[model samples]
Target: MKHWTEDLDDDGDEPLVRPYTITGGRTTAGRDDLTLITLITAQSSSGTDTSAERHALQPEHRTVLRMCGRRPVAVAEIAAELDLPVSVTKILISDLIDAGRVSARPPLAFAQNGALPDMTLLEAVRDGLRQL
Candidate 1:
């Protein structure tokens, strides 16, 4: 399959291109050679094609996507790269997962530790977010 954002993102591959804040997605039918992105828009707008806030990816989320594009990065990795607490990253990654923009599966046992592994980000973050 072709990459959705490969050539379409004419802007250089810097995470700075995306705006921070705003969240939501748009769903489109399968196209031959296009990557689909979903975005959230403010409710009351003119019926025409005016722009909404959530259309742009946030810098943090954009960096996460860029990292994911390079390889399958766990949510913790995203948190670490952004230097955000794991709880915050999970909230963001959860949005991505819920929107079908990303997927989550159980983590694997480390080469050193053979314990049955669980989803690290979810486990590590859940305890803290429950307090907030």
Candidate 2:
């Protein structure tokens, strides 16, 4: 039986590019507003054929725009989808935002003004659970 490694083709051995290279070696996104839960979406006015424009952008940037084009997505989710660090995702998002190709907004704030959940609803749920 042949080993799995033997079945794979090897080309002498070239060093793989680093992840940071995708962000142009920038460690910081340079924006203070970006957070893990921040939402991003493609700007409708950015023009059609985003794929055509993507050819001019880096692969990472193109991937992000493509995902956002469908609907709003969270920063953390984008990072997970692309298998990139959160910081790197933020940097790429920042670039798209700066280019006016995408829009970013913080997660929706529920119950503004320090409101609390109704205790009656909680009690009802507790009673239902107990009955089960």
Candidate 3:
């Protein structure tokens, strides 16, 4: 069988584009609010100029919009789903948020406190597993 990389047209050794190129050489997401666990969702009503703005966006930006358009999703999850680095994903997401195409909020408050799972629930789960 042919190697997966060999299957591509000649010059398969070269990547189509570098990761940094996607962010226009910017290393930061440009927003302090975005974090790995931040939750993001598409806006229900993207005001008037949204269409033009969307048309001008890179394909990566469009992909991020589609993923969050279905429902709220965590920033890390988005990165995983798209196979992009978290920092790069954050930059794309921040751009979308700034354009009013999406909304972003911090992770759930409970996770912030580093609380442990309830022992009672853990015990119940263990007991249920034992019964099985």
Q: In order, what lDDT does every prediction score?
A: 0.50, 0.84, 0.83
On residues 1-132, what C-alpha lDDT tens digit does candidate 2 reach at each position? 888899777765532556678888899999988889889998876356566666878877888888998988999999998888899889999999998989988655532544656789989999999999
Which regions of candidate 3 are displaced past 4 Å? 1-15, 46-51, 110-132
Model 1: per-residue Cα lDDT over 20-131, one tens digit each:
3322322221222111122221123244532453355466656666677644666556766876655556656656555555555444443346565577876878987998
Error of 3 at 96 (Å): 0.9
The residue ranges of model 1 lying beyond 4 angstroms of the native Cα positions read 1-54, 109-132
> What's the lDDT for candidate 3?
0.83
Summed backbone clashes in each candidate are 6, 0, 0
TM-score, candidate number 3 = 0.67
The digit string of per-residue lDDT tens for model 3 on 7-106 reads 6677775657777998899889888888887899988763566577668999888888888888889999999887788998888898888888899986
Q: Candidate 2: minimum summed lDDT over ten consecutive residues — where?
A: 107-116
Off by over 4 Å in 2: 1-16, 45-53, 110-132
List the candidates' TM-scores in order.
0.42, 0.67, 0.67
